[model samples]
Target: MLTLTSPVETAFHRLPAGVKLGAVALGSVLALQVTSLAGVGLLLAGLAAAYLSQGVVFARAAGRQISGLWPVVAVILVWHGWTGAWAAGAVVSGRMIFAIGLATLATMTTRLEAMLMLAERALQPLARLGINPKAIALAMALVIRFTPVLLDKAAQLVQAWRARSPRRAGARIVLPVALAALDDAEQVAEALRARGGL
Candidate 1:
């Protein structure tokens, strides 16, 4: 979906957004209960099967996204190993990753418009709390719209750093990525303001 525009995405886009969001949320919450490596393994396999059956490019995207969180994973592994809580840490980490992976798959298999609609319906009950569900939905749509843009910018920054690096420091890469992300944020703000969202 990110690399090319395809019919699968178009088909997924026609589904009710609320239904897709519900599925994603339910899958994520349920996945938390599965902590064992075997369970997570099975979940991954299931996701892969679904991805293949649906012809969605989830495996590569999910792998790229998951591997990007290795720093956090590394910290948890070291802390747990040293503190003698490796099993607990592993369970927490696995479940967290599983939820994220499943959620990503859900998004990849669904459409943004459907997601926004689902979010609006889901938030409808909160209207009594002084929340306008439609406004919240629009905000969510804007976030989803920009998430890919930011990701693409980050990828470009990484590639540029790799092209120039002999010894790449974290700060050198992160600083530029952060600045680019902030620029994207400013553009998003400007877009919203121009559309009267501000």
Candidate 2:
């Protein structure tokens, strides 16, 4: 499983993990608040400019991550188009693009350890209500870590399916992807046990 964190260093990478995550969330909220498609498009363009400032390789990596989301974006646009809500489709897809782009940027800039620490700190206040913050934080961190890995796995599965079929294999790989995810979960569980159970 590959990490989503980009190798290209930038000023954003120097910021605190919690700060980056907060910025991502705030950006997403602002993006969603825009009812106009053009507004969301501008937001996306602004994000793209920021990404571009990080250099060509950084921009390309970000582009690939955003492009990987084509399937879901296509569905939203097509469904809205069929339902005679083209504006809604544009706004929805545009919001998704910006939100996903912002998240990808945060993950690319922040290290996994930093993210984990931030999560743990954020959850600590919940411990007063009998919640084990460490355990919850660890779980959240693992999910965040594996999300891109699973996406990469799905992409590989799609590529392999395409190699053997003339038609696009869309949802056909769902079962395999699920099974693979389960296998990953099992491995992570074993690792946690070996590490003395968080």
Candidate 3:
């Protein structure tokens, strides 16, 4: 599985995964309360400063991870523009950028093992309800790890489509991507079963 954790050591790398996760969750919730463009801008500025404090290389890596948000932001902007709600669109986009930035930062700084451990710990109480915390944690980690992989696969499909056709791939690639994801899942399941099944 591909890990998002950065190799460059930073202050956030020393912080507990749970702490970073909790902070991101809280910040995301608070970000939703911010409806004003000025407030969202200030929040984004603070987020950018945090990234900069991590040094140029780390900041660039973080920026690249969040760059995928541009497509979603464009969709949001287009819808809001059609409705003639420019300010609302700006505020919504800013808030989303801030939230995703914070999440990307946390993921880049925290190790997968550390996050899995934290999730297992947090879900310990659920074990009493016939739930398997380790399995749950593993599932969460797998989702996090595979999300980028899936995105990369989709991008590759798009590129391949463009190479063969003048038109966009559009929904044509959806089935192939879904098939690829299912194939990956089957392999993972087999591996887990070989290791005594989570």
TM-score of each: 0.66, 0.80, 0.88
Candidate 1 vs candidate 2: the lDDT winner is: 2
Model 3 off-target regions past 4 Å?
Answer: 159-167
Error of 1 at 71 (Å): 2.4
Q: Rate the local accuracy (lDDT) of all candidates.
A: 0.69, 0.88, 0.92
Sorted by lDDT (best first), the order is 3, 2, 1
Q: Which candidate is the best by lDDT?
A: 3
The segments of candidate 1 whose C-alpha lies over 4 angstroms from its true place after superposition are 1-16, 55-58, 148-198
For candidate 3, give the lDDT.
Answer: 0.92
- Separately for all candidates shown, the number of backbone clashes (residues 3 or more apart, or on different chains) is 2, 0, 0
Error of 1 at 179 (Å): 8.2
* Tens digits of per-residue lDDT for model 3, 1-198: 575777589999999988899999999999999999989999999999998998999988888888989999999999999999988999999999999999988989888888889889989999999999999998998898789899999999999999999998999999999999999999999999999996
Question: Over the full model, what C-alpha lDDT does candidate 1 score relative to the true structure?
Answer: 0.69
Model 1 TM-score (2 dp): 0.66
Candidate 1, after superposition: displacement of residue 123 in Å? 2.0
